[model samples]
Target: MSAALIVLILLAVLAIVVVSMTVKIVPQARSGIVERFGKYRTTLSAGLNIVVPFIDKVRYVIDLREQVVSFPPQPVITEDNLVVSIDTVIYFQVTDPVAATYEIANYIQAIEQLTMTTLRNITGGMTLEHALTSRDQINSGLRGELDSATGKWGIRVNRVELKGIDPPPSIIDAMEQQMRAERNKRAAILTAEGERQSAILTAEGDKQSAILTAEGQRQAQILTAQADRQAQILRSQGEAQAIQTVFQAIHDGNPDQKLLSYQYLQMLPKIAEGDNATTWIIPAELTKALGTLGGTIGSIPVDGGGSKTRVDYDASIEDDVAADTAATNEAVQEALDAAKAAENPATTAADLPSQEEPPPPPPAGGTPQA
Candidate 1:
């Protein structure tokens, strides 16, 4: 408690205060603004800064590092008169500490207000749908405006981003409805197209099947007709062969007029066999043959002891045999021609036998004169 000791302690405190005020220790990425008598003098950089103890004072220490600020949601009216809420974020840095300290009372508050005003201006020109989709355009415009306006305040806006844009509930529901309707319309169109294609393909298949069936039927009918023709030809050939064989046997027997007359009589019943043969006429040659036969019978002896006598016929047996042979040949020729005609109708006229004059009609009363 001596006066000298109190004076020394006061001097030590004064020296410490002067040294502390003269040298400023600014953190990394920080700047200090120096003022001379309440007026901006110079800006101090980080680490080991010097200033007059009382003449030059640091008014503010500004952070030079980049900073991020997220603003709260703000209501803005769009061009369509719809109110939407939007929030944004900004990246900024203080480049000039002196200007940041002296040019504006509060740079952060000024930046936030400017951001809101610029966002309203940009969003007011766009519809709700456009505003929701045009986030990049709005962010770019905000960054440009902020960078220009905050230049004097020593703040540089590096980037601006819109965090969220929320449209009205009614608008969201309407958009969902529109999208669902469009998808349903597309599905219906595809279904209709598929059905049309299937119907066309089915019709084409039916037509092809019908055509093939008709072609097969036609081919079958042609084959059946050809087989019938061949059968008829074979039957006619068999009949002709049988007739030729009978005629050949007769010729080989060397039959006389009596035997030929008997054969003719036997054939008369066959000619008159049908029910329509009620009024058949006997030929003149048949009557002559009968007379010769009667004469031969008369020449036979009544008693078994008398000698048998041969009867002479008016016409020779050889002539009758020749006539019969000629008739058999003509019949065979007709049979051959009929078979050929059945096989090929085109050659029928050429193969047919020429016509001959018919015999005279029988006398009245169905009897023949000898």
Candidate 2:
């Protein structure tokens, strides 16, 4: 019974060991590399995989999914000899577990070192300013180089990216200042252009206003001159017609010298009605024509009844004016005559001064001679 128990224990221990060596659960997205006696043998896919218990040895368990690796910042000297710190991230996947196990001892470390070297080489050709501004170009270049170099190792560099690039504090400040200065320069230029446009607009407005004013004045003057010319032409035509009508009437009626003389005398009062008239002249022909007017008036008919009688227009006007005022002026004249008779001796009508008497002496304080 003791020997049988010992044999059962031995079988159980062997079974556990064999099961441990033969069965493998690779999990999802994982692969296992198996070797026979320290030599390349086979690879195990995800899920239950079987191998020889003793001869086949699972050497490496490789993750087949994409992975991320972030490296610390590295100082690189640029073309201008300026040192800058740069950090990077790499995304990669293992397609073949066999080659990934044998080709490189540490693929992650190898990738990291290769990335640092490649970064230095690429950045070394560019100035700090160019490196700072050209991140996408640098990322693409690193990705291309890493993908090519890592291909043989059964590694696929899916993508490479720059995490951060930091320059000196002084350089950052200088860049900020330069950006600020450029913005201010643009603002000033725009302001000047706006002012120039405003001035031009103002000048154009004034020029247009002046031109419109002058044009309006010219049009008004033209209209006024045309109106004045038309009025003068009408007046001249009217005067010419009037003169022709008057000449015809005189020929038909056969007017004597008396009518002409009387019409001429009547025009004298109208000529004196001028506002600016200070002096006027009377023609010498008026005196001789008055006698003809008197003789001709005696022969003219006094009324439509064909009664011929001599009529004095001046004497008739004087008689009518005296008759209207005689009653009202009689009291005033009697008072004046009585007052004068008291102040001086009573004199007859013959004692009054006639046109033949000599003129009295000039009053004192009269106007001086020019």
Candidate 3:
């Protein structure tokens, strides 16, 4: 009985070991590589997988999902002999688990090395500025080279990226200064252009304003000249009418010497009242005109006078009487001349006698005997 129990217990222990070794459970997004006697046999997928117990072994369990890897900065020399530090990131996936297990010993290390070499080659052909600015080109070259080289290793390089590129501190400062100077130059140019445009606009505005002002003044002057011309014409017409009326009235009245003498005496004071009467010239006919006016009043016939005998007033000096007579005769002659001149329709103020002239020498027969 003891020997049977021992054999059954041993069989059960062996069965558990075989089951544990044959059945493999792989997590999601993972693949297992089965090796038969140290040689690659087949690949195991996720979930339950069967393998030869104690003969086949799951050597590698590669993650089939995409993976990201970031590399540390590495110094590289550019075409211009400038050294710069660059870091990169790569995204990869395991497409074939069998090839990935059989091909490269360490596919991750190989991919990293290939990426570094490819990055150096791409940057080496460009200047520092070009290398710094052309990240997309560098990434493309890295991805192409890495994908092609790693394809045989069952690794697909899906994407490659340049994480950072750092130049020397001195070079960085110089580039910053250059950029600042460029911005300042652009600002100055824009300011100068603005000032030039403003000046042009201001000058144009002033020119237009001056032209408009000149136009307005010209119109005003034209209107003023027209108004003055009209005024002058009207004034001339009024003066002509007034002169004609006065001349006609004078002829119809036909007054005697006494009436003419009285009118002359009244006009003397008015003439003296002018603003320019500083040196008034008393005409020589003034005394004779006064004497004629006094004689007419004195010769008025009264009820007691015999036929109103005309009395001649005598001056205190004989020389005065002679001068008065001469002035009176000259006045009477001027009156005759004025009457004849007045008959002409072309008579003007200039045709009138200078001083006071007696009324048409009482028509030769109408003269009173003094």
- Cα-based lDDT for every prediction: 0.74, 0.75, 0.74
lDDT of 3 by residue, 246-345 (tens): 4335444444456756777788899988999878776578777577555443332111211111222342323343454454454445444545654555
- Per-model TM-score, in order, reads 0.54, 0.64, 0.67
Q: Give, for candidate 1, the lowest lDDT window spanning 10 residues.
A: 301-310
Worst ten in a row by lDDT for model 3? 301-310
Where does candidate 1 clash, by residue pair? none
In angstroms, give how far residue 340 of model 3 lies from its true place. 14
Cand. 1 TM to true fold: 0.54
Ranking by TM-score: 3, 2, 1
True-structure RMSD for candidate 2? 19.5
- Candidate 3 Cα outliers beyond 4 Å, as residue runs: 1-11, 219-263, 273-370
Q: What is candidate 1's local distance difference test score?
A: 0.74
Give residue 271's lDDT in candidate 2 (0 to 100).
88
For TM-score, the strongest prediction is: 3
